[model samples]
Target: MDLTRFFADVDAQPWADLHHAYGSAADIPGHLRALAGESEEAASEAISELYGSILHQGSVYGATAHAVPYLARLAAAGHRTEDLLVLLGGIAEGGADEGDSDEAACRTAVAGQLPLILARIDAEDPGLRRAAAWAAAMTGAAGQVLPALRMRGKTETDPRVRAELLGAMAHLDPPGTAAEATGAIGAHEPGEVRIVALLACVDGGLPWGAAHHAAMLSLLPANDLVQDRLDLERNEPLQYVVEELLRRDTDADRAAAYTLLDAALRSAVPEARAEAVWAAETACLLSRSAPERLAGAVEALAADPADVSSAYSLLAKLGGRAAAAVPVLARLAGGEGDPADRALEALVAVAPDRAAPLLARDLERRPRALAAACGSLGGGTSGTPFPYDAVLLDAIRARLRGGGPGGNETIRLALLLGAWGSRASAALPELRSALPGAPRAVPKALVAICPPEHRETTAEFLTAAARTGPADGRLPAAAAVRELTGDTGPLLAAVADRLTPGGPAVQEAARLAAELGPEAVGLVPALRSALSGSVGERTSPQLDADAEIAAALWRITGDPEEAVPVLAGVLAEAEPTWMRWTLGRAARAAALIGEAARPLVPALEGLLDGRVQVPPVVLALHAIAPEHLDGPRAAALLLEAAERDDDAATALEALVALGPPALTPDHRRRLTDLAERDLRVRASGLEPGIAPADERLREQAREAARGLT
Candidate 1:
């Protein structure tokens, strides 16, 4: 707990020689000092910066292990350690550094020297005890961690801490957890303790029926359970056990789960019904049989307006097959609030073809629902391309005609037509009529949506727009024109003109050439000239321009060795943080360059050892050396990257290409589950947060999963 003592015993300055996320650990001491500093604001900032730097995106750097002991001391002294406890658990669970045994080393450090903190589990501060429980479990010293958690489990009075202790016990020793959870069930502990026991019983592979059902029923709500009991005879424990049953890997368990969930949906007690709603929603994610297992509950579940949202949410999770629920969802879609919005969203997903006509009805009746319905029909979220009939198209056409002169609405309509692509070319005349004083977005949408026959005209219009519109619109317009016509005539010349000494469009021109890839072969010399002049500059635009030109040349010339030096030179340049993404892109371009890239492997490996993006780097390594793909470093990097949302599909594609050595038994199982599980809510993959997905990403995940084994 003594900050000065902790800093003195450790050669803290040596940490600066090690690596953290944004390169060397030179800046670490300032942040560490700020953690215990007098100012509240500084300490808070220190906490955030530490999370981003030391444990960036859940990755542990060389500095992470070195700094763990100090963080442990800070947690012991009560310097806001909640997020820190989670981070420590994550590090212990998975080794963040692929090249080093940091997980084992950090586990050893905590197990050998952090006994005093384990004793803090008995501290008067419940928060400290909670932190201790998690830290102990993650320490990987099962011999020490289990005994302490078992002891704490008996005397831990705070139900929340008790739950944490129970969870820790379950993770540390699943077999031993059976005996402990059995005792807790019989002892009639608090709701949280019972819930934890119930979860452990299921996790430990213990029998999960009537014997443990009492614990779930014992949960006492902050409000009256008596009024709820009078309304319906229900078991709270059963409702929770059913949710866990979704994760169970057996059909019989799932059947029992569905039957119970369906019964709970009809229960008169709102609390019982609400919990059932939560369980049913979770059940849809259990496996590919989720929709079949949950099909029986949809009607009754949707009958209650309050419960309709949960039903339709599960249906949405069930994907396009749950077409039976569309009628009810269509009805609920007319209402207001989150439920209504979700109902419409789910309706669109489950039956986009069926929902299209109904959405047209909603479009005319509810202007509030119009935007969401438009999105569902053929807008941003229209996943799997369902055609809208003349009815809906006519309605939208009329609505477009009614818009004031030209607002953002006109752009939205153009985007909707773009979503429909050539199928909605009938509406192009309407869009063309509005283009007189419309924004540049209309032209972009027109380029994206119009048929190939109109490409010449679209190209000519966008080219004219580029000449006269705002400077900001020039690059996009030039890019669009290139896409439309593929005619290098003026584009190559225009881009080349910008490469002159002090031309304002030089960088923009360089970016356009890069976007055109190999087609802009004519602009390679200009890009090369731009690269030659821009090297070694510390400025950001120079860094970006350099990377862009390098990428452009490798793409145009089809040679990796020729591009490696320039790309590597950009990486070797001073002030790398600003150009890190550009550097990664350059490396990827070099990877595509083939055998000439062999010399760059040593440098690419250095990028992997640090906190730089590893997908492109690992991808480069995969393309270069098939032999190194099986190492602990390569396997760890690929597996981690293969599961991330942003990089998973692309990373998995590259990982699969590295061949079966990268596909371990565990990786195979994980991939199989992801493949077999229908993650699509309709045709699109379930996007994180509120963002909707395009159809291509949905197929990407599926294809990666299918290719795994």
Candidate 2:
């Protein structure tokens, strides 16, 4: 496969001036030569370099347009044909700047080589045929490519190749995809081919009828057969079906999804049943009724001893909503080993009160269950802490007395005892005995659990830790000393030292300095130094540190000179696409400055339309420029953010700041609905930790509604 014609004018082009992800494109010619060389090893390395430099992370560059023609020619000559076709397809998908001539040129260059791409769709190699199908559709020359794909779909012999052809047809002609897919989903086609056809129907927005649903259920656990040969959206067909149905959010669509999943869960095959259970978890994350509808079915699976681990994980994610599974979980918790511990964890998340006695009974054997109880019940703002059972407290005391708890277990024990506050005074001697081994974790617990008579001793111990302990323990110790003795002397000096530029704890130090107010007047120079020391383009953390320092300086010195400009810059700058939390921090600092932030009103107003930005922007405007705010606009945005759970607590706080007059009758009704709904406002994705935060948001919404009335 000689490439003399392909490289005829490659060197005549000025590759140095053109740019890729790696700056100069001067090395692109060598990579291109090596990619077509005889050695397979060199070709592999060269292609990887080309992907890194020219099409880096899916973003095409100026040099990518120039290289597309050569790539297409190499692929046609049957040299790494499949790999080159895949690369050409990716470049043709337009990762460059929208409407840029370079992006247009890249697409045009690929389209010009459609003859080569179309020829490979009939190649003897199934892999080459699949790649050719994908590349042909990506060129966007539908007038020419669609007829060829429709022709190939009729005669493709391999099931995998047929599935690829169906996907390509769906991409080119969505309205026509349903008709083409219907023929492919017949009894004659293979299981994987029918599954792809079903997906194509969904992708085309065709009405899903009874036939389609029946066909999908017959192909249970198609995950094994529907290999990701073409890099389709999801690897599991059942999961893809459930997600698409629930995303439509219509009652009829959801009903159809529930029927299919319910049948799959009852299958006797272990793998099929497990896959169905996994798909049900996806449905639960998407739909509010999924936990209630599927909980009993999942609980039935828990009856089997071997299936308990997977069932428990999903049940724990369901949280209190899976109350029906508590009986089954309770039975499993009585046994021994990892399954029992897992059952206890699920029980703790579902019903902490009932799980407490069980935790007390097996405290020595179930470390994970104990940790789950501490994590789920110990830290939230709205829920009750883990109840203090006499048996549980005694077990903890035994562990401390015998010196059995390790570092992490010791911390958990301290936190559990601290939650009981003065009620746990009976265990004070044991806590003190365990203190020397875990000084950093124990002092905070000691200050919380100790009575007034013992506070002086605790304070003395903290003072010693503050002055001479490890770097990680010093500031926390000083903070505890201030909490116990009301002495700022230790904390003030600690804050000044931690506020040094490039320090590890500058954010926390600056926040503590703000709490000291005028007492921190001596630390203004340090605050100012940290504020201006950001290098290059400010990153998210750098922006956050600046916000904290600015707030500290304003509180200490009451001067807007240093504080206002940084806040203004944060407000005026483009929000980082990655971190949505940075602007909220800056908005909070501006709110603290109050009237000094008057100059930032326009910048904050410009940020009103963003969902994540609304809560903080509303609060900032309320503090600095309330008269200029459009109450209805702020209220609508706040309600939208609250509904989507984009920082629901902050949105409710903004609602409170907007006051009752901002909320119309409709707004109040919606707010009441949010307060009283059984489903959590923030339930998205698979994070089980959001349960407590959702409870907190619900309580805030209830408080906001009542206060408004």
For model 1, residues 1-709, the per-residue Cα lDDT tens digits are 6677766755445876889789988777777677767887998898788878877876767777787777766665666665455556555555422334765655555565457557677888786777678767766667878888888777778877887787778877877888878777654566656666766787687766665544444442312322221111122445446655655656667665666666666676767667666665655543345566666666666566666665555666565656656777888876766556667767766776666776566454443234444453235553344455667777666766765535445655566666666777666666655665454456666776678887787778777756665555555566677777776555675677667644556667776776667788877767776665555554555655666666677777776555677767766772434555655665676577656677777777777753345667777777776555544456567556544443555555666666666666776666554445444222224331122342344456567656655
Q: Write the per-residue lDDT of candidate 2 for residues 1-709, one digit (tens) a residue.
A: 4568667677878899998999989998888788778989999998899889878887877898888877877787777889999888877876332366767777877888899999998899998999998888877788999899879877888988988888888877877888878877777889878988988888787667788888887787788767755645657888888888877767778878887787787676777777887888777665667776776676557566556556776677666777766777888899999888888988887788888888888787888777776663334422447777887888889889988887777877887888888888888889877765666667777777889998888788778877776666677788889999999888887787787676778888899899989998988888877764444477677778888988998998898888988888766554645646778888889898888889888888877777687798889999999998889778989999999988888999999999988989999998997887544586753355555566677788999999988
Quote the positional error of residue 103 for candidate 2 in Å: 8.1
- Residue 375 of candidate 2: its Cα lDDT? 69
What is the lDDT for 177 in model 2?
A: 86
Compute the lDDT of residue 436 as modeled in candidate 1.
Answer: 50
Model 1 scores a C-alpha lDDT of 0.62
